[model samples]
Target chain A: MKKTHYSELWCSSPRFWGGLTFLAFIILLGLGATYYMEHQGHWVTGMSNQVVWGLPHVFAIFMIVAASGALNVASIGSVFGGPMYKPLGRFSALLAIGLLAGGLMVLVLDLGRPDRLVVAMTTFNLKSIFTWNILLYTGFFVIVGLYIWTMIDRKVNKYYQVTGYLAFFWRLVLTTGTGSIFGFLVAREAYDAAILAPMFIIMSFSFGLAFFIITLISAYWWAGRTLGELRLAKLKHLLGVFVGAVLYFSMVYHLTNLYITQHHGVERFILLDGGVYSLMFWLGHVLIGSIIPLFLIYSPAFASSRFAIGAASVLVLMGGFLQLYVIVIGGQAFPMNMFPGKEVVTSEFLDGVVASYIPTTAEGLLGIAGIAVAMTMVAVGSRMLKVLPENLEDPKDLEHA
Target chain B: MSNKDDRPDMKRREFIGKTVLAAGAASVAPGVLLTVAKAGGESRGVSSDVRYGLLIDTNKCADDCTACVDACNRENGIDLVERPKGQSDDDWNAQRPQWIRKVQLKDKQTGEITNLPMMCQHCEFPPCVDVCPTGASFKRADGIVMVDRHTCIGCRYCMMACPYKARSFIHQNVAQQLVNAPRGKGCVESCNLCVHRIDAGDMTTACQEACEKDGHQAIVFGDLKDPDSKLAKLLKTKSSRQIRADLELNTGVRYTNV
Candidate 1:
């Protein structure tokens, strides 16, 4: 393997300024949406008493999960000793940090009392999964930031391997904490399963790698760098495996619920008659997120086509977003099972009926802006830092891959 | 034969004595509750020695009665809340603060119907307390689970954790809040067992008082620790059960004859 050299992104180009300006515009729009929601109270959005969490959570959670997953390239190269992947480590860590910052911003801004974030930070209910996440989420920034330093600094490059190991372990636990937020909800039938922890971990891998693939291709192409065809092939195949793993976990989750007689109501709701929820699970999550991506990446017809890889990655993100929507919003729409055998004849709180949620334009804008925040971070960071490799056109032997 | 005839008279006399004694205790419960806490009052604060509770006879809960609900709203100043401008009636109805609301239920197998006013159960080991990230949802020493408005960031995780759906978020800007309730926008709240009244050394809650005023007398409020208290005595007489008893929450509120 040849010595890998990294360089800063060119900043004077018209495309760079245009892209950065577009991201800034999106971020401004998102902030405006947030201000409107906060001023009007959560009532302005589709969120209600029944559905407390809305589209913002779906966006925030997906970005956080993908953030952890984005670090996989760094983990593989540094901790697992994949020489071919070493050059990608710097940008991988940067992207991970950027995604997390953007995601956290959305999570905090969407709070009913975002100004009281200080209370959340200062006060601690050590038993609650959310408090644990606060510590884990912040801790992740420090750990990953340090790991990026090890990769970028010439004097500390020797310690990159050790830092990689720590980052790898922290991200696993961080995603676990995220999953347990839903997992520990014993009151709701849709959550409260231990399987959620591993499912989230697998989700991070699939979503993260897909995001990384798209970002890498776009970045390299913009810089006029020599991105090797073999490297793209390897990433696509790995993405396929991750997508397959996600599918397996999702199946097991549904199958486990099917065995319980009590969980039948919730299962029937999500799988059969949950309207938009059922449709998204089948068409978006299963077909688009997993199956189609697998075919596009592994198919012989699209072996040399970059568009196939890009399309597959985009589909995975869209499908993953829909999957999260089903998990967060769909889970809340189902009424609480207060009575096992008896039916709630009538109640003021909309008991015994499925909740309806039609997300407003403000909510949709805020969610998409979360992605823009991540992109802007990466764009700015790359301009000032030497995270991108100068060339990757070296098509190595298949054995190294 | 003479002894048997005398025993019947003795039994009748004893039954009347106990009934009168129980009735007397029920009437003076307010005085007992006040005296028990008066030694130190608010200065000494609530003690674990006294566990506040309520016992409701669902069979006696009138189908058309909104007395208890109306009383709670008046007491907590929930009545002052108005729907914000441009808000739909449907949305406002759903989002309005409800410390307590009437609930109707029907048994699937038996076709038996029951009407009850549902509110916070005030569980001994409340799920809301466990899930709150900021320790804002806390249980008092006397087993009253409530949200501390000062610290609550209004994340609404408590609402999700509560099985009863007892909690509500203030979606619109609040105005004309009573000093007792201290309500505001973007905060989670519920029936705090009329904690303000309890702290002020009041013996009865608004709902319990209204239930009695309207001649239903379906609700009883007293110290569960005092065996002589009306609530405890009634609990012993009736086969009362907690909602979702399988969860073993050991709720402070119990119902009978549902």
Candidate 2:
């Protein structure tokens, strides 16, 4: 591999300031929304006793999942010894940390008592999956921070491979914990399957890769530098494979649910009768998220086009959000079957009927703020540190074959 | 047959003698009677030796009566929030906190209708207790499931884990709350079997009192461990079933003729 030079992103351009300003505005708006919701209580939002978790959870979980996925580039380079991917490793680590921070912020800020974060950190429940995730998230930052340090400093470079391996393992556990948050829920009919854990891992892979690719292309374009077709093609293909894997797991999950007589109602809700859920699954997740991206990545005519690849990446992200919406919100929308054979003729609560949820403006802003936070972190980190590779155009470095 | 008739007469004479003696003692020393009553009633702290339970006779429950629900709200101070101006009544109803509710159900196959009050089943191995991230949702040693509000982070995982949909999250700040209940915003709660009343040595729950006072006598509350108790004797004589018994929750509440 040719000697690679790393440099900090120049911040003099009007575009950089404009982008940063825009992100700051969004973040401020989100904070305002958070304040209003906290002061007035959750009544101001669409969340209720039935749909307990709402829009904020959807965004927070997505960013957290994608954060683990973003480190894949670094793992491929350091753990798997891929020379072509090595140049992208530093940026990958940075983005992983940045994205997680953004996601955690949203999660914490959306809490009923954000002030009680200290209590959450101090108290520990060994049995609860949420508690384990708290540890996993913090461990990820420390381990990945060391891995990035090793990459940047020549003196500590010898530990890069070992650190990268540790980070990789921690990320797997983190994503597993996230998935199990739903999978371990035995009370809900839509969850309780073991497949959800691995399915989330695969989802992280696709989402992370797509996010990394989009950020990579955007950063390079802004800098007026050429990101070689070879690296782009490699990332595009890898993303395609991950997206395909996600589709396979989703199919298996639904098929397994279909096979169970007990799960027939839930399966029917997701596949047929559930109006919004069904639309999101079929249209947003299947077609736009998986099939369309797969087509764009594999098609000979569009495979090499930067525009097509970028568009596919964006679609994958949209699909990722839609998938979570179905899993989290749709799962809650279906009323719990307290009485299996008897129909609830009348009740104070909405029993034996679909619960309705409409996201308020505060919820929308809070969710959008998560995205802005992640992008702002990436922008600032790139500008302040020598993260991005100067160029990936070297022929010798492209010797993946 | 003549001996059995003589035995009944003798037993009646003995019961009347004891009743007269008890009435004379009560009239003679009112203060001592009060002490005796207190001693027989209040127990110090909850003990695992006794499990509190409820028996509902669905057949006796009135179809249009919501006495139990009303009593629960009054006891727990579950007041109605004025519907937010722009929101529909249905939306507000879905968000309101309800500790107990009257559910009317009709059998799909038999076309038979039943009226019953539903609340937390207080499962022996509650799913909410298992899934709570902070150990806030827990079962008391006496088998009453409850939430420790101070520890609850408002994650609402307990709501998801309750199969009966018995849990409710306080979505808005509460200005008027029962001193015993102490409800607040962003905390998940459910029926605690009137824990405060139980602690105060009241054997009957608010719902149980209301039901009996309304002349229904449909709800019975007692210690499940005592074989001589009314609940135990009723269960022995009557056919009773647990809701969603397939889950093997071993619920503290049981129903007859459901």
Candidate 3:
């Protein structure tokens, strides 16, 4: 085993520093955006009647799914039980917590009345998917944070293990709950299916695997260390399996929607001819998110190299972005009743039926800032706390540290 | 086992008595409502005028009366210029709304058209009330569906849950809204059955008043429960239908065949 200085491994590399700086700048931008919104109401944002929820909502959902996926290392350790994932388990935990915090920040700022956010918990609408989502997210955040804190502490109590189990159980439930929000909306022609919840599960699994792979690669490269062939092979194979599952689910979600006449109206319209939203849903989410990433991860020759894994991870993340974007934006693109040009379709007094909303430059900038904030938090936390295990390759090497 | 059967019988009789009381209240309630109004009107030295609700004969809707919309905006202190369109979560009338919309639907095959005014159905069993987490969206004693903005969290779940899409989310503060019905962001809003007017013993809505003034009493105003009221008489003689009856919402607003 190659011995390295503990201090050097824990310190931030130049790339890490640069990434941190960029991330901080973006967070500052997001803060500025939030301030502007609070002072001036939602008029500051480009959101109007048609596209009420835009990039912030999309990014929030994406980050939430990504953060859930980021916890896989710990999940594997507790449930799947493997020493291979142990090295990066703490890092994953930290990333998961940090990313969720960042996601919540985006969502909180997106609200028209940020002051009334706590009312979400107090006034729980049992039938509302959104109300359930708030509860699930809050529960998931608390449990995940406690689990991570316990893992770092040397003399943890038995309750910590219980806490870890609670986290795992609730995380699974939360993903299903997120899925059910869209799944239960029978009135919405676009998203009425039993498969949506399972689809979200598969998506969460795919995103989680992709997140772990990318983070693992980053830690290895930045720490001037490398993974064993066995571990890398296992990860690659697991990613391949997840990518295939995601592909199958994605195909089934749309194909099923297309098969039914009632669903065909809005589903086909959005998928085939519903204009820009259709293009993004079909090309960005399905083609790039599912097909390309599946091929990259599953191809044995491609999956073996670090470069290939990195490429696959990037593809999966991109796909995840489009996946959420399509679900949120495409869900709204179709006229509510699937009948267009009617008086209801075009507010007779107003210009159009659907109020048009495009994310402004400020909205886009704030989204980017949210991303930077998440990455910076992860980088900073890792450096200060020595989150990644220093001598995972060999215990004898730990003596040197 | 025999005692168990007798126990259910005792419970059933009590339930029947309670239901009979409720039904009797439901039947005699409209007359009582008018009598109480007459008493109040007498005390206030105002005319004991007939209380009216728009019957909205779909057949005579002209399938296009921007007149009602214009008058409602002018009378109810609604913003006429900035109209919300499409599937939006955040609408301008997120709170403090006055003008109600009437959507014209065209049959895909026969080319036959009908105007469906998209207003709060003032349902006897409003799902908005059943599903409101905070009891903010409620049905008044007289049967108008209204929301208490002060307690509303503005989550817009009621908007999503409402099958008819009658509820609107207040996205911004409407400082210029009539002081009687001032509203801020984070509330779901809808037609209050012109409750402000109704409370003041004014039977007709701003839209109905305007429509009547235009010599187009395409809108008939009366109590549904009153046998002699125009709305009740129309229901007994004519084949009137409520929108989306399949939902089993039992909406108060009914329209005759076009």
Best by DockQ: 1
lDDT per residue (tens digit) for residues B34-122 in model 3: 89997986575422243234467766665557667776666656663244334244544322343367666666665667664556777
Worst 10 residues of 1 chain A by lDDT: A392-401
Please give, for residues A12-43, the per-residue lDDT of candidate 2 as tens digits.
Answer: 67989998999999999999999998887888
Model 2, which residues run further than 4 Å from truth? B1-44, B80-85
Question: What DockQ results for candidate 3?
Answer: 0.12
Order the candidate numbers by DockQ, best to worst: 1, 2, 3
Across all models, the iRMS values in order are 1.0, 1.4, 5.2
Candidate 2 residue pairs in clash (backbone atoms < 3 Å): none
List the candidate 1 regions with Cα displacement exceeding 4 Å. A395-398, B1-43
After superposition, candidate 3 runs with Cα above 4 Å error? A1-9, A12-18, A157-161, A338-356, A392-401, B1-55, B80-99, B123-143, B169-173, B185-188, B220-233
TM-score of each: 0.92, 0.91, 0.80
Tens digit of per-residue lDDT, candidate 1, span A184-293: 88888999899999999999999999999999998988887888888888789889999999999999999999999989999999989999999999998999888899
lDDT against the true structure, per candidate, is 0.89, 0.89, 0.67
- Docking level for model 2: acceptable
Comparison by TM-score, 2 against 3, better one: 2
What tens digits encode model 1's per-residue C-alpha lDDT throughout B1-258?
A: 146675887778788988899999998997788777775565678889989889989999998899999999999999998788898877776677888888888999998999888889989989899989999999999888899898899888898888888988888887688999899888899998899889889989999999999999988888888999999999998899998787789999999977
